[model samples]
Target chain A: MKFSINQKDLYNALNIVRRAVAKNQTLPILTGIFLKLKNNKLTLKSTDLELGIKYDLTVKAESDGAIVLPATQFLNIIRELPNEDVYLELNQDKWQLQIKCINSLFKINGYDPDEFPNLPQVEESAKFELPANKFKEMIKKVRISTSKDETQPALTGALFEVESEKVKMVSTNTYRLSFIEAPLKTSVNEKIAVIIPGTTLQELNNLLEDEGSVEVEVDSNYARFTFAGIEVISRLIEGKFPNYELVIPDESNSNFSADLSQLHGAVKRASLIAKLDANIITLEAANGLMEINSAEGSSGYAHEEVKIDLEGPDQKINIDAGYFIDVLKVLDSEEINIEMIGPLNPLVVNSQKDGDKFIYLIMPVRSQS
Target chain B: MKFSINQKDLYNALNIVRRAVAKNQTLPILTGIFLKLKNNKLTLKSTDLELGIKYDLTVKAESDGAIVLPATQFLNIIRELPNEDVYLELNQDKWQLQIKCINSLFKINGYDPDEFPNLPQVEESAKFELPANKFKEMIKKVRISTSKDETQPALTGALFEVESEKVKMVSTNTYRLSFIEAPLKTSVNEKIAVIIPGTTLQELNNLLEDEGSVEVEVDSNYARFTFAGIEVISRLIEGKFPNYELVIPDESNSNFSADLSQLHGAVKRASLIAKLDANIITLEAANGLMEINSAEGSSGYAHEEVKIDLEGPDQKINIDAGYFIDVLKVLDSEEINIEMIGPLNPLVVNSQKDGDKFIYLIMPVRSQS
Candidate 1:
């Protein structure tokens, strides 16, 4: 393959596709980016078998061909090249690619394009589109709660469900859970639900642009997302997601609202000490005031107070400080609404933006004090 | 002890002294920062035994006392606190310090102040002053060549010497060397020479500002630097430095000048491939053009060319690309002057700034090919 492309454009495309390049050396070909030149357009693709990303850009082609170059080396060379025209040519016989830019030349060893695994295909019949910003927002809220434990395969991903005019994403690690729902219209007539790997959600969040729409298609095994000239294919978790609706509380004995920034800062300071122990902090709300305190460890004790608008009775709960801080960081509102049934039950954070709903639940831990 | 100080000022002082806080747990008290409030000045000190830093600030003192608080914990709490008056009170009996700021309160456990080691004193008779920025520049250039090998104690630090009106710092790992000399008037009548530990040079570089002058005092065992209300005391390395002057060639068979930034970029790009092997790259200067090439490894080959103005015969040398890049990164010059005797001799880079002279040498490595 022979092609000449602007250095910046090529570098940007390589960055997008390289996200799915396999980190493991089990399959050497999977660690490479497949480059195909046809019809004056260069298509770059990478896949680790579980996740794949593809990006295409128009280039001036002298001859149409294909090659798979090591993602890291190729990306580094292109990134270092000046922002001018870069010429690339493939030597099919030796499986070597020559890259030339201004006064720099590099000959990089690559694998045959035929050895690269194709990305899993998603059936177009089950396709829908959603606003990129809203989808990214839903992913950001839920992805944090996804479990890192691999033993429970289903919990390592977020459950994505779409019905009529509503889209919802839910994730939980048993101790903390995130549930977010948005109103988005799509052409789907039937309800659909799929569990997407947390890693894929992270990459999607990084790639998604705020000004576009994402076309999503899912089948029994894979889910495909297309947005802003980039395509991402992710394998779906086969196991069933737990029934998260039952865990969400329908009523609370007491509720309070505190300034989000103030509460966030207080919890962060308290955690500096709490993290030295079990990271459990006591949160108390009463008489228009909120108190956050960490149990004294060998290192020290931390106590922070913030003004709150309280309703109903006084409330106190001992929960993981990290969980509370996560929800607070992702929240966009000036005020934060929290509800508690009792110290033994879960502490719930509820937020609303543009008619969308977000609920975060943190299970209380047994206080050491 | 009881005192109130502005959060920003206190944080800044803590930041400076904490640099010397011991990273290891060999001595628990050494990991803490000593705080003493006498009269209206609050002094903070930390030492890792080999290096010590002290900083002082004025505060509204209600009482006078002393304590040694955990460096990291205190720093974190202060960093998170809002910019306001922070009150600190010591619970002398319990060895815990209570810190109150706006709506936050912290009780941090600390060690007895008496257990903290005192910074070594440098005899004031051998003290001299130098402009902070120039000293900082000299440190930056020489520190990079300090060897990481612990077996050679002398090479692990920079040789610092001040004689007459010339101040010089030199360091080398045998393969590469950096020598810097500056002319400045000082009070010292006798010549003084000491090896400053690389880690101490790093801390001094970080703490020195551009405006003031640094008062330096050296004795047989320790060196002291005082500037900008911060005092740093470092234990000197005890060993004879290598004869680096003999390695810097005074005469050359070939000389060349090239754009510093262009050479830097070309070497960096070439190193991307050279590093895959032993990081050796060949540099050829002839016909007003300098060509850099990396030996072909299992991965690839890289070639870069930078325009140059050459004098004398053509020259070619094989050197570690990393060593070449280091001097390029530190030199502040539009055009870099290089002198070489032959391929078997060391390649020297000579630079001058504001009447100060700097020399960097990279010994050639025998080419594998």
Candidate 2:
């Protein structure tokens, strides 16, 4: 096979699919990017059994063939080449790929194209299109709460819940939970729910562009997302996601609001000391101010205070600093509202303005002995 | 001790001394930054036995005392604090430092100041001043050639030779050498030479600013560099440096010149393939073209062509691609001149302009069987 393409086009396409390249030693060909040139178009595909991505671009083709080359080496060479036309040719017998760009010519070894696994076929039983920005935002919010514990497979992924007029994403690690719902004006009679691995959402977030819509198609075993000529297919986790709504507090006896930036800065500084132990920081809200303090042991302690507008009653709770910081980072609002019932109740953070109903609940940690 | 200082000033001072903090499992005190407050000045010092640095800044002193705080924790806390006056108070009985910035307050555990080792002092036998930018540039060019091999302690440092009117820095790993000399106008009755550790040169390069001059003092066993309120003292390596002049060819049978950027890019691309083995690439200069080729093995090969102006006989040589890349990255000239005597002789690269004298000699690698 022989074809020539712009260096930038090839580099960008490689980057899109490289996220799915296998990082394990289970299959050698899974670490390679499968390239096929046919009908004046080039298709690049990468899969690691559980996740796969395919990117297509038009190129000047002199012949039609296929080959699988090492993903990292090929990407590095293409990225280093000057922004000009790069010519590629495949020698079928030797299974070698020749790449030429300006003054650089390289012949890279490759595996047989036939050995590379094909992406899993996804059937569109429940399909819908959502704004890429909103989808990306929802993924970012819920992804942080997914547990990294592999033993609990259901906790390692976020649940995608779709109703007739609204869509909601939820994730929980038992310690904290994130639930975000967005209005979807579409003609769908049935409800659909799928659990997507947290890692897959991370890759999707990285690849999704803000200016387009992502068409999502899901079956019982697989889910496919297509946007901007790039398609991603991810295997759905076969477990039941925890019911996050049951854990979120419906009402609170105390409500406190503070400037977002101030609260974020205070929490970050307190965490520097709190992380030395269990990373638990105590927050006391009363009167017109809130005090955040790190436990003072042999190491030291940190105390930060931010003014707040309190309503209902006074409250104090100890929560994981990292969980609070995560929500603060993802939030773009100037102010944030926190609701608490008592020292034992879960602290609830609700997103205000540009509202689509977002809530983050953090379970309070029991004071350590 | 009690004092108040601007956040930025404290952060900058920490950066300078933090370089000397021990990175290994050495004495615990060596990993802490020594802080002393006296007469309205705050001095920060750190030492890792081989190298030491001290930085001073002015602050509002409420009292005078000394303590050593954990280097990284203090630095991080100070870095994250808002850019305002930071108040520090020392509890001598507990060896704890209390830091307050804006609405945040932190009390960090620290080591007793008496336990921290003091920086060694060097006798002022020979001293000279050089432009900070020039010294930084010279350090950048020579330090890259220093060997990382711990067996040769002397080769892990650069020889600093200061004459009445010239200052030269030289470093080598036996296979490749870098020599850079700059014109100096200073009063020095005796010639002084010392081998400063490569790590010291790197830290100095990072700390030196472009605006002022650096005062250098060298004795038989130690060297001190002071500039911009920062002072660095490093122990000298005791051994004779190899005579690099013997390897640089005075007369060449082949002289070729080419666009620096083009040749650099071509060689970099070719090295991408050659590095899979012994990192060897061959340069064939003939007519008006230079051909760079990587050996074809199981991984495949790379070929790159660069236009050159040949003034003498054609030549061919094989050398370590990494050594060649080091010089290419340091050079700032638009055109690079390469002088080759024969296939067995070392290749010499001469600096182009600015009247500075610099030479890089790379020993040829024996051809692979």
Candidate 3:
């Protein structure tokens, strides 16, 4: 195979596929990226058995052939080469691949391309497209709460529930839960819930462009994202996700509103002292004032009072300050409303202004009396 | 004890001393900073047995006392608090430190100040000062080559050689060596060579400010640096340091000069194909052209040529590209001259311009063939 392409264009295309290539896979061929040059186009594909990515780029091709080269080494070489046209050629035996730029030449050994796994086919299924930025924003707001523990495999992924008019994304680790809703263009009479691994969602979110839109297709067992000449396929976790809607409290006896930044600052200060023991901080509300405190022997105690507009009786709740800070940071709101039913109940947090559909619920820790 | 101080000023003082506080020390008191409030000044001191740092800041003192608080926690608290005047008070047998700022109150437990280690005495020994920026630059250039292996404790420190007219610093790990010299003002006719630990030099370098002079005092067994209202004392490594002067090549038969950036770029590109089997890269110089090459079976081989001005016969040498890159990055000159004595001998590298006193020596690796 022989081809010439812009250095940057090839770098970008390889970067997306390189994410799926594992560093030390049991199979030696899995460490290489399968490259095929056909009809003036070059295709790069890589997979780790569980996740796969394929990207295609146009190049000036003088011959057509295929080769598999070390993904990481080739990528690094291409990135460091001076910006110029890169020429790639495959020998007759296809056992050696040569890449040249300016006055530099890199000759790399290639594995048989026939050993590479076949790319999965995406059949006609429930397909829809959404603005990339909007999808990324929704994922960022909810993915942090996904369970990191493997014991509860179902909770380790985000639950995507699709309906006729809206699509809901929910993630929880049984301690704190995040739910976000966005308008959908697809109409379906039946509800579909699939547990998508949090890691896959995060990688996909990073691959999406900030300004453009991405097309997503989902089947019973897999989901595919197509954008920027690349396609990402992730397997769905086979399990039942817990119903999150029932866990979100609808009414609260105690409610208050405060500037998001102000509350975040207070929590951060209190967390310094609270970090000794799971970062548990106490929040007490009384007479329109909220006080945050953490006490650890010899390290000292931290207490910060923030004035808020309250609508109910006085109450105090002890919760993990780090969790609250995470939700507030991702909410990206000027002001937030915090609703509490009781001291031992889950606290519902959401933005006070209109137009945002993000809600976060954190279960309070019972204080040791 | 009671006092009030600007949060920013207090944080800065604490940060300077925090470096001496070890994270996981056998003695618990070593993890705390001794806070001494007396005579309208707050003194923060931390010690890790081998080194100690103390910093003082002026504050509004209503009473006088001392306590030891957790270093990291206190620093974190002060960092998160809004920039304002922070009021501090000691309560309950001086075991709790209450910090109040704006509407926030933080109380951290404190240990008895008597348990903290004693500060090292500042002896009336040789004393001199130098420009902070210049001193920092000298340390930055030589410290990277300091030995990280603990087998030879003396080699793990930089040798500070002081004379009446010049101050020289040298560091080596048997593979690579760096030497830097600068003029100094001193009246002591005696010469002193002390091995100051690399960790201490790094910390001192970080705390130094630009455009000012730092007062330095050295005794028989310790070195003290006072700058920016902070005093740092470090125990010198006790042992006989190797005669590094003998290891540096004094004469060369072949010499070559090239642009520092250009050579660096070529070496880095060639290193892509070289892996951790000593990462050996070969440099061949013939007829005013230098070629760099690296080969690994099945992985790849990289070759790049750069034109240079050679002053001697053709020569070929194999060296660890990573080590060469490290020494090249420290040179302040745009053009570097490399002098080769033989194919399998130490090479001397220095700036092409006259009056540059810095030199780096790298030993070539013997080829297995």
Per-candidate interface C-alpha RMSD? 0.6, 0.9, 2.1
Q: Residue A69 CA error for candidate 3 (Å)? A: 3.1
Ranking by lDDT: 1, 2, 3
User: Which prediction has more favorable DockQ, 2 or 3?
Assistant: 2
Decide which is better by TM-score, 1 or 3. 1
Residue B162 shift from truth in candidate 3, angstroms? 1.6
> TM-score of chain B only, all predictions?
0.99, 0.98, 0.94
For candidate 3, write residues B239-353 as lDDT tens digits. Answer: 9889988887788889999888878888898888875345788888889888988855447788988888999888888888888888777777778888897888877786532
Question: Which of candidates 1 and 3 reaches a greater DockQ?
Answer: 1
Candidate number with the higher DockQ (1 or 2): 1
Report the lDDT tens digits of candidate 3 across residue range A80-105. 88879999999848478999988788
lDDT (0-100) at residue B41 of candidate 1? 91
Query: In candidate 1, which residue ranges exceed 4 Å CA deviation?
Result: none
Which candidate number would show the highest DockQ if scored against the true structure?
1
Measured against the true structure, the TM-scores of the candidates, in listed sequence, are: 0.99, 0.98, 0.94
| Residue range B1-369, candidate 2, lDDT tens digits | 999999998998898899999997569889899999999988999999999999888899999999999898999999999999999999999999999987899999999999888899887658889899889989999999999998998899999988898888999999999999888876777888789999998999899989799998888999999999889999999998887777777788988899999999998988888988888999999989999999997788999999999988889999999999999999998999999998999999988455578999999997853
Assess candidate 3 and give its lDDT.
Answer: 0.84
| Cα RMSD for candidates in order | 1.0, 1.2, 2.3
